[model samples]
Target: MHRPALRTLLGARALARNPARRAMPTASHYHRTSNEASTAMRQPSTNTPRPPSRTGIAARIAHQLLAPCVLALSLGTSMSSHGAGPAAAPERPPAGTDVDETRTVAQRTRAPADCLSVVLEGVTVLLDRSELSRQAHAKPTQWKTEAERMALIEGRRAAALLQAAAPAQGSSPACHPVTQTLDGDDQFVVLAHLERGAAAVLPAGATQPVPSVAIRYLGQRCGPLCGRGSIMVSIPGQPQPFMVTHWWAS
Candidate 1:
């Protein structure tokens, strides 16, 4: 073989014999790989952003969820209160059973019985006793001579009896014939004139108390006597009609 060709062949054989140099990694290659990995690590992650604090994250979520719940609860409470309030109660109650139910002062003063208006002889009277007396006092009674005398006797008897029995309502009867008049629904006047002699004669003294006059209606007792405007009466029934005197006209 030629010397140059032989030399080339020998070098190729030597290069093939030392394969480690070709297989081994270079410093530059390693450095490049490291730089690429570092760049990937530095990039922003796909994961969500971190909150300023754990509590901050929780608080934000809670606020969003809680606001609607609180608002809903408040609205529900307001509706409940409105539905239960007094404006919900009824008006114009019907007559109840006759079992004498107790009532408050306001109920008694504001609402009275829805009584029937009835006529007695020539006069109209309220079915409720107090109303009848109230109307009678407003108008003067024009009685015949005999009727007048009878009225005086009746009035005297009532005064004497009340005075003798239980007194506290008045010192004297303060009785007189009817003068002024107001007819209650033009119904019956339950009350009559004052006793003639009784008005002039004061009771024996302050110690001698005048007894209250008792009037009967539907089997119920009413009044010390109806005058000045008011009556003490008993309502016998359930959801009870409040006991009261008609003091309005007076």
Candidate 2:
């Protein structure tokens, strides 16, 4: 072979034997390698966290729905621990005959069997034995002559007329009349007079002789002509038909 040809062949063999200079890469190959590297970087990683599954979402919804019930139970338990429990029922009265007996006993202890009540100038005036006795002795009376007796009656009538005409002054405490009866034959009567305040009594009746008195008014307490007023009497056993003296004023 020629010397130049032999040298060219030896250089080619040397280049092939050296791996670092074996071949030069093309532009398309370099572009393809760059694209693959970029794709790998952009892909999502298996190690990264993911969004919640359907089961997890359902669990959260269930917790929200039950939260109110759990809170209410806790509050109820706390209140019970503090002694705020359900209230007790009120006591009931006895039924039938037992109830009647209890009421009778109560009445007997509180007031006299023959007691009566009176109302005057919108005020409830309670009259008992002591009150009646006081009024009877308030003014000395000696109606020895028929003329004096007649005068007394006329004066009382005039006072009643005056009281009836007078305007009500003001209000007073409430006092309701009782309806329970004493012994069947026992009775009650209320009487009013012009010169006297008022009186409550069980007058002489067919069965009973002596009067069972409750209250009596002292005669004319304040006056230029003396306090003038009408009288009202309530009859026991009946509801209405009260006996009233004619209106009068001094």
Candidate 3:
């Protein structure tokens, strides 16, 4: 009776130590389960998705946000870094050639009307009103040199065109003059041609001896900056003169 009682106590203790063994699992069963759990922890399932790294996320963001032009510039930079040359852009006009660069333009005048407007053959010109009036009625200036005499003669002729035309307003789209700085001031000059010519309009206070073509001088003649300029116009027998803008280095 005593031995049986002792055996029953030991069995109760063994049951208390392993209460999870309700099915009375064998050693092999435990081994198989341990191996499966370790393997599952070591290797994730193939179908499970992984989170992206920091670098990969940044690259995707940049690809979405960058523009095509930015990408092209980046490509150019990259090529240059790899000892490849980049294409050069023009900085200034080529020398020795009178470039018909009508594209190069100064500031738009907003129709300020700094100079007086004069029209001959329907083409308009801007000039100093006082200077034109003085040149129109002035006596012969002393001929210091041939160039000086020619300059005075041209000024008189230009003043005549101003005197012949009445008070008028005109605008030119082709007057894309270049701006140059001299004596702390900016200067620009332009020339326009008339498509057709009309008989001289002899209004009040007109200048005499109108010619077929007239050359006007704005600044001092022959300057890198706009010190002076001369332009010649060929007139036609038509009634109305339409201005045609021509751009040249002045």
Candidate 4:
């Protein structure tokens, strides 16, 4: 019946008396529970959400086809915006190359004719019959009766020849009956005569006529000194006339 037996009997009596009183867990048990909780925290969780699954073959094929198209579209857009793409250049012929010889010759030939027409037209205006007669009579020189009569007749004839030879509507020929010679390269000397040594020489260009005192004097000198009647006209690109009149007073 000793102390151990008595202690056991007292513990049983307490348990019966306090049914609500529970046994406290040991420190080892608490340590084991803490280890289990730590392991649970360390391990990866399966409850986390997973990524959405892709359409296996169809998605891969679509990506493969669209990748090149997207890359090409982006490259084209960049090139167009920057203006860096190479382009074909227009072809140009070498400098000083003659394209059409025929056309060039035709143009060269046509220019002289046009200049000639201008000369004829200008001379015709200057040598009007009544105007020339008036100018002749107004001069200070006194001519013999026969010479004065001849001068008037020659002036009328010169005027008539110029008017008849000039173009009625358009361009006239380079060698009209009134034109004597066409001379010079850039400028032209136009000479026309109605009587002996009675001539007019004017400088004409493509557009304008220059006044010549020599020619005016020649036109006026027909009263006495003039011996032979001759006309000379010069167009551009021709030699100057050497002898304007065939005869002069001896």
Among all windows of ten consecutive residues in candidate 4, which has the lowest summed lDDT? 100-109
Residue by residue across 81-104, what tens digits does model 4's lDDT show? 221102211221111122211000
Comparison by TM-score, 1 against 4, better one: 4
Model 3 C-alpha lDDT versus the unseen true structure: 0.36
Model 3 agreement with the true structure over 1-250: per-residue lDDT tens digits: 6999999998889889989766787999999999999998999689888899998987776545543423322221211122101121122222222332312112222222333443434443334444434544552566687444544553455454544444443533122111221110011112211111112222224332133433221212232222211123323343333333221222
lDDT of 2 by residue, 1-250 (tens): 9999999999889887896675678899899999999999999999998999998987787656545533332221211121111221122221111111101000111222222343432322233333333323432255776444433433343233322332322322121243333211111112321112232232323222112212211123142322333223333333432333322232
**RMSD, model 3, all Cα superposed?**
22.1
Cα distance off (Å), candidate 2, residue 217:
69
Lowest lDDT 10-residue stretch of candidate 3: 180-189
lDDT of each model, Cα atoms only? 0.31, 0.33, 0.36, 0.34
Which residue pairs of candidate 2 clash? 160-246, 160-247, 160-248, 161-246, 161-247, 161-248, 162-247, 162-248, 162-249, 163-248
Lowest lDDT sum, 10 consecutive residues, model 1, at 193-202
- Local distance difference test, candidate 2: 0.33
**Model 4: lDDT to the true structure:** 0.34
Among all candidates shown, the one with the greatest TM-score: 3
The regions of model 1 sitting more than 4 angstroms off are 1-23, 46-48, 52-250
Model 4 residue runs over 4 Å out of place are 1-144, 170-205, 211-239
